[model samples]
Target: MRMFLKLNSLRKPSVHVKAPGVLALRWRLQRCCFCSSPQNESSNISVLRHLTSKIKATGPISVAEYMKEVLANPVSGYYVRNDMLGADGDFITSPEISQIFGELLGIWCVSEWMAAGKPKHFQLVEFGPGRGSLVTDILRVFSQLGALLQSTNLSVHLVEVSPRLSQVQAQNLTGEDSQSARDENEPAYRRGTTATGLPVSWYRRIEDVPVGFSLYLAHEFFDALPIHKFQRTERGWREVMVDIDPDMADRLRFVLIPAPTLASSTLIQADEQRTHVEVCPEGGVIIQKLTNRIAEYGGAALIADYGHDGTKTDTFRGFRGHKLHDPLEAPGTADLTADVDFSYLRRMAGTGVACLGPITQRHFLHNMGISIRLQDSPLCISPGSAAELPQRLYSAAPAPGLRYAHQPEEDGRALQIPRPAEPPAPLLSSGRHKVGEEAPSTTSGGWIQRTGTLAGEELRSTLREGVIGQA
Candidate 1:
């Protein structure tokens, strides 16, 4: 979804999902290790029933609560118990497509680590590392650059709540080298070492990760965080809540409360412009944590998710079997997500960190010399698949599997995909720049962030070409 360029080849004719919130559908590459809802419709009942019990006791629940209980209830929650990734699951991530995404990221990590003066201790902390593909790719990069990391003590810390997916990450990354903690109550529930002797640890939350000059990565992670949906009313803003539909015992519906709830009153900005907004306090809290660490101890965080910069409203959506579905229907049977508001994340960061919101995979990769990388690699798409998509969806000069569904136009400008009947979404254009020229920056938005004072002059100059600026 983070990639604004690549819209999935829709299965249902004329049903194109809007972007920068993309869910790519393809013939398949890797089977996602995450558990998914069984074909049996009865399997979703437990989550639905539990929600009804909570609602009956507490009245209508906020959208945030609905998401939390439905996706992470610890008992019948979707993510807590499902394998919902890839072609067979509810979604597929950029990492699953090709090594370029992760490899470029790995290179960025090394570059940033160097910028941080090459700390003796390096921690690669990733949130929601599905099947461990991204981190595995990064680790390989680290090993490949033996001398660059030779003197640094490196570790992998993952903040993941899913026990089943944790097992998958362990099997893929550490194989026989990892083990569950003897005590279930430990802050780190699982611990392991890779074949190359790098230690890895897993935690249910980010608060437990040790503070250090670390590199933080969250790919397709923030959008899944529960968001409080609000609608601007004639008098004021009202929080959208979910309640049992009076006419149907088995269904849920959205209701606008007459008065603002604690969330609507506190989270909504008085200067708000959007008629609707989705705010994720959890995402804010996580950013605050990362920024504080960046400010205090010196680290960086690169968050990749589909989001708009203070521009979009009403992007909460659901996906089941790779197509749009009613978020309120069937409860835990689908994957519920909202577009990340990068502007809000900047507000939480509080100017302490140099935050960059969105650098399209196109810009970021091109800036990272992906053209050279692809030329040296063997990965390729079949002519059959290539012939199916519009030429603009792909540039004449190809980067293997880089279709990430978006292609730069002939004029070298990024193309914005609009939803049917909706205006063309505002282009997620990073402000302009070149070497020694001041770059335009809005403190309220952007994605890739490098913290600390040592962002490096050369790094800044090179990155400025792609709009990766120094604050």
Candidate 2:
């Protein structure tokens, strides 16, 4: 995970990481664990010095080249060995919030698996299964449904770039049910453990994840991939870059360069004003490949991220702990993310795999029964006991509870709490679906809209078959 670091020609200073624990510990000692000051100030200085030295040695270089070096630098790069999760980390993710979030997603997976004909062996893979709470909640639910868990023969796969995070996940999942048992005698969920009584495999990249009948889940995964940001200029959309100077440390600045060809058609309307457009070519490529895999093989995928309805503005920013920060603060230390492009995703998925959403995390989860699960939890009404409840359940918990995912609207700002939406119809016609002008309902007769076209009589016959199978 090499990051491209850069410095602006007009920047006051450059930011760099002197040592891993120094900046992180400074915040801890101050009890401002969420502060971005140390890394931002330090990174700016380090980057400025590195750039100045580089320019002296090799002459002037493009901002893009410099950023590439800073982030991906072999020895002192940020992403090489970073653990930016939890209260002391750069940012928190959905699975870190609560078990219900992952539990509901697990339920969603069950339905998807059944829709996919209940393959004897299928991989339930997650991208950055943060803190493993989501997976744990999911497995907890799986444990309850003995038939579903046993029948599917679920093999869990995780693609995590951070080895530190991988260990955290393994601790929560592969150990004995210590957390689930009595508090007084609770044991730590051991690392290198497998509570499933089943093996779990961890990999660094999606390409390494074995292909098969699989269910793909990526919550807040797309945004972290490096994005190419372009602002509409008089000439055309120019790419955004960061320039750093090693000598003038503690400063980082954003700059733009001409990129006539790479500028997207979507930026044409914003040409009158200097509107910024962001694109993650890497994330798009990954989506294309994953969609192709799902289409070719029998499977489903759900991607939840903070992104826009279309490719429009530059939605890139940085974060430390729970608060937002100037994106230019730290080269590699601070968490950098941008909005995902659902339009691009849908186009990539094509007809092979049905891409139901780029829907808001709220709406998607609501439709899939997150709210119901939340309401049923014992802690919902009795929430005042622990402030940790908000951080753990609503904010970033490693247990099975409520979780958060980002929702970026058109203006480029993100919604704090994702509101749930109605779930998309099942991708394949489950025997449960009745395709007809009249809305089909669950046997309990709950209204659900059907899109496109399917034979009405055939749909009803299929529904009846499901009813019979249940009986």
Candidate 3:
């Protein structure tokens, strides 16, 4: 992670292609998190100044601290004030890339909801919902569920720190029918209602969201949490620190602490083999909370991000505009993130809950029946890197309920929630799926129309297979 301490040129958005009924975005989904917005460059100078002052007053700060201040510090954080998630912004998300992405994940949610025996109350909790496109696509599927959900009470809860992004999400998800909380003391900082009349509430932290039969989604969210870097040394692992470059007063650089710090001593395992490691304590804490909630209240969590199962070492980097940038140079001007260590997250989940495969994004989507949509679609991969991306980014989650074995496809692992022993098909799949023919149910037709998918029947069988799996 020894990146040059100079800012790179502003980056560009994803390479977009236009074909009938298709938009193929060529970019790595992991690189998509918290890119940058050119509009915020001049205003981002405040964070560098703020970090300089803090480092001078104290000492070299941990990498985690620097990331926290750069990305989510209350005032001048990058995410706090920028619309950084589209063609004009730093990068684009899967949701922004294709409506199909959200629609499939939405189907997964409904599959889990049905597996949960149709709980009277359902909460759709999303963390770091950029532009709200993902959840919007999801709610549309919920709307298509119709009669199945008429008896169920549904609500949306978002955990977001950026007021600027929150407003963008409110506009997209709620049609401007939203308002800020009356006071700072309230747990929900903002609240709104969707066009469909579902309540959407905003919170700054995960624990504040209400507990019940909840479906938790974290798309590229954990990768944004601050991580501490450690380099294996002859004596022991040394924690990486960020400090003002002694040679250049205006610059910042990485430093290695000579002695053992609490993080270096506690976070690493005894049998660790990697020469370099990055640990995200904040991500661990959030996982513990999510799993605890799932174990107690009976729900599921789906986490998708650019990550590894503890294989790679040096992954912490920055993205400005759309290209790799020096993480320390401009501070809040670039997105500072590290690849999420799903292995670390699995360990944090502990034996209290079952941990599933960190499956390939391609496999998960294929299981979700994305191939059914790509049939006639032509893809022009961009930057030559997009072709290399599918195997790199992965997803991990427990099934929405306990009973369904929910075995994963191929190498992907899926966590399953325990409930009464029976996994029913997704509500949309209520009618038998006959390949090459539309589902007999009219709701199925409405679902396909609502999602704007061209293939009406091809997805039914595969999507059902993606749902409850063999025990």
Candidate 4:
């Protein structure tokens, strides 16, 4: 009887598991009461029968092997030891909701490093730099100007691949000096007590830093990489993998297969139904290698995230301390994100890089001024939070049902939505022009799109040839 149906499918499954310090011995198994299987397909067929019985007694193993002793074998892997974010870990980032979102991204990184022309040795990167409070409130607003923070040449990189949030952003960028410590040699700046000595550098790849002309800051970093989910079906899109269970003990599974590529499946079969696509191929190859290194050494990248700018079907989910959970129910112990079509990251950052404003993290921090850094900070000379700081920089309290989902263009009919308006300023200005002469046309009638440059175009071809419009 095929060895009693392969020893009753490798026995073991009377339930009552709970490792760590042991307490799991209850099997008198019988199953087959009209066997229905499920329980995530009997925990992926007992983890593919204990990896083909350990590759037939240890031998042929490559199915791109990585069951890590069958699902994070132990000591977690979802980021092996989490602390994802706030309000109790996972989901809270907008520079963890305050310090006016890292002091208006430190005045939009000093107006994109004075529009890159003032680059002395610019490289103030920060991808996944949580807990470093938006790079210490963008280096305390680049130490309040002070001649553009002492004529640039600043180096404050911090890529971070979580060694537990890079030791909580090197202990919150050497604690204390919460804005207004203008380094007049204010020594002893905490963190493993290195004394005010700020000169940190940490990386986990972006080709191991080193490259130049950098000024990127990712915030919510492309909704936490690792996505690739799918589900269109009816013979078009499928993929969605993850399976575990060594004779059942904390199961864990999700299997689908078949989706090789319906144009890089982000799952969308439509009239054929089944729609759950969610790709992120390493956040579109590290956002086309950080916009081809800022279009070959120039600079400027912000990329805030929430997602939705077209091409539908998005699958990105997770959450911890705040609850929602189940990104494969704890593979590395929770914290996965998604939603960033950013118009396919602005058609893969082309036109030699210059795609500002996918705007709306409340209109790019209220047009990168954060209502004049909250009416010139000191939270406006406090006194019961000054009229709610201009109603928390222009009101936001009416999201009860808020269901939106429409935008999905590229000939799938209308769907480029997201234009509630107000993210035009940031073509970078602080003196002399010419970077493709500050584009900004909107001949006016509404929806006048021009983005980077076209505001004049030979002064509108000299008023359409009637030279200066009949003077």
Candidate 5:
């Protein structure tokens, strides 16, 4: 592994290692470590100065408000600055890991479409489509469906806010050289089509997509939404806020607002002993919109991301140059994210829709025939790449879970959480269990380990073959 230094304005400069063969595993491990130095003065002072001025004028801001300003504030937000994907960028996603992941998802979509009576016209939409890798693979697989590609009126819509990324998506989808010509007054839906022969459009919001039968894909999308952090205190839960450090003058710090609000009221009953909890209204709002769209217009969504089903814990962090950095260090230079509370998404999904399998991606892919695909089609991936795939897929102990939930207003419409024959053993060697052995019940401090390994596998299997009715 060859390491190099990447310096930014704030915090101690980080040493990013270029792990050639095992980049995925190395990057993920480093990200989870949360090992980075304190905040330092940044080179990009525009956003920082703007934030400071705002805070000084209006007082401290919520984590969600800070995240939105730093990440989506048109002029200097992180995503607005440039593309942050692939090996040289901040982080690599699963679609970028291997084409196989997308292919499996494409196949899964086809199965669902068939079950949905193969609607004559339907939309294939993706949210936060980074570099268009996943959708590209999906279109390729759809092309293999012969008449299905030609007969069915399948239009592609990408729900992306970044202008730079939208241009990248257009290029990937259309093959023709494309650039975003977004007008200041016009809505951000760029009209185009893929080389695979599907008409495509780009939108800044999900609501912009035309309402109809649709298949929505949101991989690693919800995690990026802004989250509100709350800490349990003697006076009840206090909302976390971002403020300038009085001592450092240039650094940003986390401060709690002592006042209790309506938002913190519900969380107080969840747990009194827990230290911290995150609530992402942005993510919840998106889920509600998606579920409402599916229920009203007729469609289904597949969400794959790294998060616990319902566990309440602080997962807020930052990533830059594929390494973990202090989230509060740099304002808009690094990607700020928190784990998706799938349970919250389920609860907020409202009535008339079913939520299925917050199952592990490992089991979902395994049931989708990932292992067999590698063995049967050896030429699909090189040996070097193949060796790294499993480690990347299972590197984070239990990989990100996959959820396949949809509305049941139409015939044969259902959500599945397949039950795997056996649970997968933990991949990380953390003094708990060896490979292929059952995980230990409790840790040294009497902390019970609620491993999602087997539960994920079983959920995947159940979704594949079984049907769970609407609650």
Candidate 6:
């Protein structure tokens, strides 16, 4: 008999029910509120059984393989489910937090495009664009560039795997039927035009994007890719695997392969100390592809995610209902993710590709003149609320890194802003600097593109005291 051990002490039991029939009724009623639905749970059980059978037949699977199955398996994958993002979902992204994030990014894109002498035709691509909020905000900002918009033939390409998220992204992008709607038999690449007349397309892989001057944005993307975990043992490092828990037939647990193979040995080099490390070869592979695209074609790519510069520690975690959960507890129920090793990314970028700062997000935004934009805006909020903006923008993990790479011909200037010892104090300290005070001038030209008319000035002045940046 399999002895089931409850690993999650934090998980609370359902409310008490006296009668057996009433208990069954209560369970049916309460199932909707839980992380996994009864149907989903049943599906998970089936998947679990399938995995167990596979393991018994073929031996244990790598952590990456397990993650690939649980989070991206076509039929029963966690991302395949509709409810997987936002406040009600597993976790919220930075763009979902504030429009300011995407707006600044749009300004950066415009500046870079101008720096590149304004390419007549280029591809604007986003990888794993969750719900399309960031792209929508970016396009809105792009719309401010009137004549520039007309001159540039911008084609939007979203690289995504989840059909459900693609639908949401389509709705956000076009406000109607998506150009590249879900068709299992659909070719690797599909194209369409948005309601705004901008050419849009969907690609399952980055390689499918037509070669051209391409600007790619990947925010909180690389972390979700499956990773291989290795622990330094007395002899050497061993690869982590997922197998059926001997004590609990229905549960899964991590198990290390007994012998260290050449592949595992070549992949990771660890000291004698018992240290844990994670490597996302999938992420590394994607970086290689991206860097190749930028190097061969003329353009830039910006990757923003919470991670360290090659930290040798295990950062694998799961999130559900805005709270931490055991990653091994319930497969296909929570968001599984691991910290990115930015050093790995830099190394994979290759010889000619120039890499920029893996600087803190606070430093990046501040240097991008987030404060200046906030001061000139027409949003309203309390001083206390405004103070929390920096903290909120501070990622779940510290020091969100930003990497910028471009072709040698297209101005290889790095977007690295000097990091401060600490994040600057809030601009609106103690209610000082009343409305209509002269805002400080910036060296970087304004990308907001305000109309130079008396009525427009009046509107700007009115919005000067608003608190859109408080987020």
The CA-based lDDT of model 2 is what? 0.45
The residue-level lDDT of candidate 4 at 90 comes to: 37
lDDT of 6 by residue, 327-353 (tens): 666677777766667666666666545
**Model 1: per-residue Cα lDDT over 16-131, one tens digit each:** 22111111110000111111335346658877888889989998899899999988888878787787765456655545445545666676777666645576777899988978
Using TM-score, give the best candidate's number: 1
Once fitted onto the true fold, the runs of candidate 1 whose alpha carbons sit more than 4 angstroms away are 1-40, 379-471
- List, residue by residue over 1-471, the lDDT tens digit for candidate 4: 000000001122221321111001000000000001112344445445565466447533321133233322333334434554543443343343355556555654554444334556767777767667767766765664444458556777677655666677776775442232244333312113223344666666677676766667665556555555555545655554444443543543344444354433433334433266555555667877776665555555555544554554543444433333344343344444445555555555545433433323444444443445544454322223533543333222211111114422222121111212221221211111101111111011110122112222432232233221010
Q: How many clashes in each structure?
A: 14, 56, 11, 8, 17, 4
Model 3's alpha-carbon lDDT is: 0.61
In candidate 2, what residue range of length 10 has the lowest lDDT sum? Answer: 22-31
For model 3 the local lDDT of residue 373 reads: 39
lDDT per residue, candidate 2, 142-260, as tens digits? 66656545765667887865555667777777754222223323221121436657657776667877777677776656656766655555565555555433434455444344344
lDDT of each: 0.61, 0.45, 0.61, 0.42, 0.56, 0.56
* lDDT per residue (tens digit) for residues 103-196 in model 3: 6677766655554455678889999997898898788767765655788789999999999989989999887799998899899999999988
Candidate that beats the other on TM-score, 1 or 2, i.e. the better one = 1
Off by over 4 Å in 2: 1-79, 176-193, 244-250, 258-274, 379-471
Lowest summed lDDT across 10 adjacent residues in model 1 is found at 428-437
TM-score of each: 0.76, 0.64, 0.75, 0.28, 0.74, 0.74
* Error at 108, model 5, angstroms: 0.7
**Overall local distance difference test of candidate 6:** 0.56
| Clashes (candidate 4) | 8
Model 5 residue runs over 4 Å out of place are 1-43, 177-188, 266-273, 382-388, 396-471
Kindly state the number of residue pairs that clash in model 2: 56
